[model samples]
Target: RDRIKTSINISGVLFHFVDTAGIRETNDAIEKIGIERSKQEISNADIVLQILDVTSLNDEDHKKLDDLLHTIKKEDVPVIRVFNKSDLLDSSQHSISIVSRETVISTSAVTGAGLQELKNALIKLSGVTDNYSVYSARERHLNLLKAASLHLNQASDFIKSNNPQLELFAEELRESSDNLGEIIGKTTSDDLLGKIFSGFCIGK
Candidate 1:
């Protein structure tokens, strides 16, 4: 974390590291819980870092990668594919396509090789500005989106009917709007706030 003290400009932007963790695989129940927690963190993050051992992106690893990618996709998260240990690989044997549209950065983290390029890539991905404003949402927001979409379908069906119930359509629209308001915390309850903040660490 001390390495984060350096002052640097990236396309006229400043950057800093907030948190880091080392993932270890094990069959123990506690270890499994850690894995699940890591997965949750990735899902909730705006960007994900997927580190791959450059020298061993073989069949089994590829299959595991496929599964991991599927999970990330399902969570609608963007990933930066880091091909680590690049210095260990022979220059001529360095051709691999891990994920489509993913920004790939080959680096020897040991020697700080290609670190500058990696930092630039990350800054570009993080589209923050002096007047940056983010609209945050939760799982309830997604559920509301789904409900609104369903009501939209219902509205479409009503538009096709010979004699549509305008009252029904209006009620559906109101319910959808309420769901959305709850999602954005405009109409949310204290219970939801508790659930959300409880998931984070005490200091956060």
Candidate 2:
């Protein structure tokens, strides 16, 4: 987790630190390794917080956003899209637009603006909204869960009548089970394992 981590204790609630390297295009071999490590962290993260520098967004930033988001989307995890340095955003900044489906928050870390709202968004998306276990599950687990959920919902709609599409229902169950198996290394590929674990402890 490098020096980018710290405890944020607010109103008796303390959260563990999970930080990753900033993703960007780089030519240095050492930086490339760091980027791979960051990708690993992102794949295993609970919820991703993508912070965009409102004042510095350019064409290159827009291109990079698509690549970074592709990694997150593969896991089907919730994302908190934050626009940082809102204090520096001029009123004319509205002319520049970013298209995102996730919840967006304008934040000024220096002024503590939108800090509470950001935390609230985190708590809600992390499922602290419910009394569910907050175990840090992997990307495969989430992907499988989402697949299972989608199929299950579809199956329910088709099973309303006495004569249901048993074949389709069974197929969905199999798909969900197969996805779950991948999470436990049973059906996972060696390539996936290599990608997840081939990282050095840079600042541990």
Candidate 3:
């Protein structure tokens, strides 16, 4: 229920939000799977939105939040503490301070309140610029490029050696080419075969 029904677009940056099942000790088989998935998402998340029931806040919940915060801190992820059901809270119960460093927002899902503030907080925390580009580069692309660079560096070292091992040098060059090819959605063997069938020299 915590998940947003749709993706939010702010200043041309698209934000995809995922709602996770409450993480707690449960013996239910399906619940355990969901908890595991939630943990996985937390580890990979750029930002985490932790929703809390304003009316049911208790000591046990605070202790759990602290533990979760500790784990999140180790990964250097930012978390926003959202107190839901604000419409039900009495005036005197409004001044609860859970975490000093985190961004806290009082929200009423039924009244459509505090939604704008949440969106604004997300935009600020994401560091989205007015001219943000919609480039398609992902983590895998950078990893592939890094691998290619490493192979090329090895090939360079072979070249600089007093007695260069031509076979090893060629192997490194091939590996580099393979890595580079993967970035462009090609495979080294496929590219080589194509060239060979097209009347081009294998060495070329």
Steric overlap count per candidate: 0, 0, 0
Cα lDDT computed for each candidate against the true fold = 0.61, 0.64, 0.73
Q: Evaluate model 3: give its lDDT.
A: 0.73
RMSD of candidates 1 onward, in order = 15.3, 16.2, 10.8
Worst 10 residues of 2 by lDDT: 195-204
Over 171-200, each residue of candidate 3 has an lDDT whose tens digit, in order, gives 777788888766565557556445534552
What is the Å distance of residue 74 in model 1 from its true position?
A: 5.1
**What's each prediction's TM-score?**
0.48, 0.53, 0.57
What pairs collide in candidate 3?
Answer: none
Candidate 1 lDDT tens digits, 1-204? 111122344554443332333345577776676566665555556666677788876556445544654766644555677888988977786666655666788888898877888877777688754464323333554677898789768866765689765555555555666676654435433454455346533332
Model 3 is weakest, by summed lDDT over 10 consecutive residues, at 195-204
Question: Could you arrange the candidates by TM-score from highest to lowest?
Answer: 3, 2, 1
Model 2, global lDDT: 0.64
lDDT of 1: 0.61
